[model samples]
Target: MLSKEEIQRYQRHFPLPDFGVEAQEKLKKSKVLIVGCGGLGNPVSSYLAASGVSCIGLIDSDVVSISNLQRQILYKEQEIGISKVRLTAQKLKELNHHVEIEEYNLNLNSKNALSIIDKFDLVIDCTDNFPTRYLINDACILQNKPFIYGSIYQYEGQVAVFNVNKSANYRDLYPTPPNPESVPDCEIGGVLGTLPGIIGSIQANEAIKVICGIGQPLIEKLFIFDSQSMETRVIKIKNTNARDTITGLIDYEEFCHPNKNKMVKEITVKELHEMIENKEDFQLIDVREPHEVEIATLDGELIPLGDIPQNEDKIAKNKKVVVHCRSGARSGQAIQYLQGKLGLENLYNLKGGILAWADEIDPSMEKY
Candidate 1:
């Protein structure tokens, strides 16, 4: 049922014996929902849209910052501070007028995960954080949809297929979310600009194959590619009984961990600015890694998370200690460790960490 223009446009696809008009038609009929339109989301959506996916749903609660241009291909410097999903949708539709682009410019939370995911036949997990990735996996499992998972860290990237027809899932592979502090991010762990492009393209390829039921999908297997070494490895994942306990969608926050995040007193960026303006005497403790400090940093002592115990004595005990990281999470963990574990009660977690400082107090700073 393709238009004359569509037929001629995809004539190259028609010549492939296995993927003729039937596969093209299947692709046109497929609805693929891509969550997290960041690094991986860029190429995943671009290729799928170019492949002529019928309906492409984009979910992201992020804005296009100047730093995202290095890897987020869908955005440009001109589009900075704009909504990611909205801009991605416009660009994707412009790429191919026949492709329907649905933009959900909201954060995917426990409340909205099921409803949003169920609308699409497949979901792609391009999220950077662990919480959303787990949420996507669980939602796809509950909704009985296939999911393409891709992640980038430094010079390496990983792609996996999970929750397809009750195949092995993320839980079977990891079974638990790592402690947030233990994991490194692109800000702390830098990625090559081309790294996500490689991984995301692979994810898009897998997504289309799964949609058209053409080539063998990467079901229950993890594909690991290291751009630095130019090596690729595939590991088989076994299905687990984790689904037995998952009858319905429970709170994803509590599912990842408990309702209890590390307990810490926090001070907002405005409040911190006030303290600075008022010339208050407080010691700022930046608990981010050395590399992260190099990117965008606050004026503070650079005692990393791992070095806290050894350098506890170096932490200024005379002044009120304000602990911070890229965001507040690491600082929260640091505060909890200092107070709950190490018995230092005078620490406060900066509300949004250095990123907040960049957005509100200081616009000169750069971060991912």
Candidate 2:
């Protein structure tokens, strides 16, 4: 069914012993939706495009920042200020003009998630946050689509294929998300630059295998990688009643934290702007390290949550205190420190942290 030019274009892959013309043709007919366009999405998108996935959809509302240059291989310095979905599509187009690259320049919230997932043949969860990951998992299960899951911590990463028909889902492996504040993000905990690159490529591999109907998929098996040790671990998972109960993308944000009222205080990036403009007399504290300050400046004192007690004098008792880190998790810890020790009456958290602030307020600020 391929034209002369189509045959010539995929000539190299077509001649392979196991993956011949059939595999290449399968790739040309498959459509994939990659969520988050970030660390994991960058590598997944790049490899899938290069391998000639016919229709690719990139969903992200983020812009390329200087700090992302470390591992987001799809972007360059010139594309710094551009939206992630736009720039990613542009680059992927250049890589393979034969592939149809689509862009959804919006965050994957509850409102648009179902409509988006229904359009693609498969879904890739490259999102960094727990809320979005659970959302993607639930949505894929409801839609009966295959979902490739990837997650990374300091130097470790996990990958799996979830929500496929007759296969295990994300909830089957880990039924409940950890306490939001209990886990640290890549910004707070830090990740090796090449970590996502390795894991995401594996996710893309699973996608390709699914399309070609070759090789055993990683379904019901969670692959763990420790880059430092150059070791990989595969943990087997089984289907459960809990996964069956997941009908659709429920309030994942609330599901992750059932007692939202009793949990940490939350605020939006817009709220932070309002407080700043109104000249709120709160002790704005930045918990990020001093080196990170060289790239971004916040209108707050730098106490570096790790060294908070050493600089306790900077936090006044009577004044309101607002703490923020890269993405608000550490800021919650800082809040706990201040409240437990200083016992401040008025304390607030800049919910999504400085990264969210940059995304919402100033696109020019570099995100770490």
Candidate 3:
């Protein structure tokens, strides 16, 4: 039963014909687990808490960075480097003290995914990576719990409801994980600041619908939204009996990253600095976008990742070539492509990319 204060706080919700006192009470009794307390997680948790979900469990191991300020709304500029889950929990409590916030300041892995997910009635996939997404899917399938999946890339976002009443799971839509190199995260491929807000609110709406037993949730349908064009599409998904094969959790990292054994060669920022000091002959290629170069760069020849294939002639073949990006991921991808497609033997990824350079070699360099 809602207290007098609780009733007053959620008075706006009490008026909806379909969502009345009983629905609000249902919300107050529901437990939700949100994985990845970044972008999407920010608005999902915020609206759910504000809507009076009884308990919201937040799980994320990341710390706040300046880059997160663009889309992650719950954090402040002053809170940089603070634990994401910790600050998010504090903020959610402040928003709705009537709601309980459980913080898990650790990465979700195979060992803990089932145990943690078992605690919540429903799970929301706000995670950016594929490994965690697959992990959550399998864990939820095993636990027989439903999950709302949301993802944002550049100006586009996707939201889906999986395993609700034994409906289509993520694997039914994507039988296998895509190549990790092909899928650049929000950090590599930027997202509009407001994109998460749009998608996450929809996810929260679906969650409430699921909890309250009101309107039709996004079951067996994938909702895609493009912020640039303000367009939307819903695709029907057919279950392929993928869940029948799921006996237990496997190493999601290995599952998603099939080429994990083929490691890319790397050179530390400090080593690059030493080579610069010694005036050694080497080619430093920046694979980051042009805008990222304006933010912070090591003055390397600008060759964006997309252009790397055509601009291979520009990269030095005789001298050692070190490719870099904002962080090392993109550059490593560039190196992998060069090595595989062109069979270039002299390429090395700048370990940690320009971020590492800023942290280790140059204190004055701007970091985004």
Candidate 4:
């Protein structure tokens, strides 16, 4: 039931023998939910909308930043300080107004995963952390929905399809999440800006195949790509005993490794405000780039996360150093870095990062 204009808009795709008006219509009818609108989510969500997916739900608890402009193609410099979901929704609608786009500006957690996945036909896990990935996997399995998973580290990326029609799941491949400290992020390890783009596009293609019901889906197979060597390899995964243990969606973080994250140095938003008021003899350091401070807070010292190791001498080892970034993600790494280098036991992370401070303490402060 595409109108004359709709047919004209997608004329290029309709003529393809394998993907004609019927496949396009199927795409127009399918609902795909994308989690974590950051690196992989940005490209995956954009292409799905441009390809005419009828309903694309984006779930993210992040905002646009200047640093993200390098790879997250959907955002622009002007959109800095805006919610990732808000800006992404506006742009995707402009690209293809024919589709429906839903935005959730809240973080994904065990409490709301089921209700969220229940609304979409398939879920795409573009999240960066292991805890969130495991949560998405368990939710998809519990809801009996297929999920496309994508992850990138430095110059390498991995993509796979899981929990489709009771097929092999994430747990079937990796029984437990890696130790949080053991896995370094793109921020610390440095990822190629174009890495997620390549991986996310593949994820979008997998979702289209899942919806069109054509081509062999990447079931029980994990595809790994290395941009440096320009090589692609697929690892075949066999069913594991972990499948039998997952009767229902249990706590993913605890299931991964209980008490492992108990040592994470975190403080509540309230605790931070109290420190600022009491004028506690502590340095509230903002580890994001200098440009990021123009849009966000604590207005503290600017030592980008990348330069932490070299700039340790600049930090006050005697006084408490309360470190933070856009979200609490980078600060945790920063605290860990300092502890290992200077053994600064007084180092603390601004819990939930500056975002929590913006939400709880100072709403007037721009959230970027």
Q: Pick the candidate with the highest lDDT.
A: 3
lDDT of 2 at 53: 90
Which candidate has the top score in TM-score? 3
Per-residue C-alpha lDDT of model 2 across residues 317-362, encoded as one tens digit per residue: 7877778888777888777666668766577888888888888899
TM-score sort, best first: 3, 1, 2, 4
List model 1 lDDT by residue over 111-187, tens digit each. Answer: 89999888899999999887788888888888888989999998899999887778888889888878655675776
- State model 4's lDDT: 0.84
Runs in model 3 lying further than 4 Å from the true structure: 261-263, 277-279
Clashing pairs in 1: none
State the RMSD for candidate 3. 1.9
What's each prediction's TM-score? 0.91, 0.88, 0.93, 0.81
Error of 3 at 341 (Å): 1.7
Model 1 weakest lDDT span, ten residues long: 255-264
Off by over 4 Å in 1: 257-260, 288-298, 302-310, 336-341, 361-368
Better of 1 and 3 by TM-score: 3
* Model 4 segments more than 4 A misplaced: 265-327, 330-347, 352-368
RMSD of 1: 2.5
Local distance difference test values of all predictions, in order: 0.85, 0.84, 0.91, 0.84
Model 4 clash pairs are: none
Model 3: clashing residue pairs? none
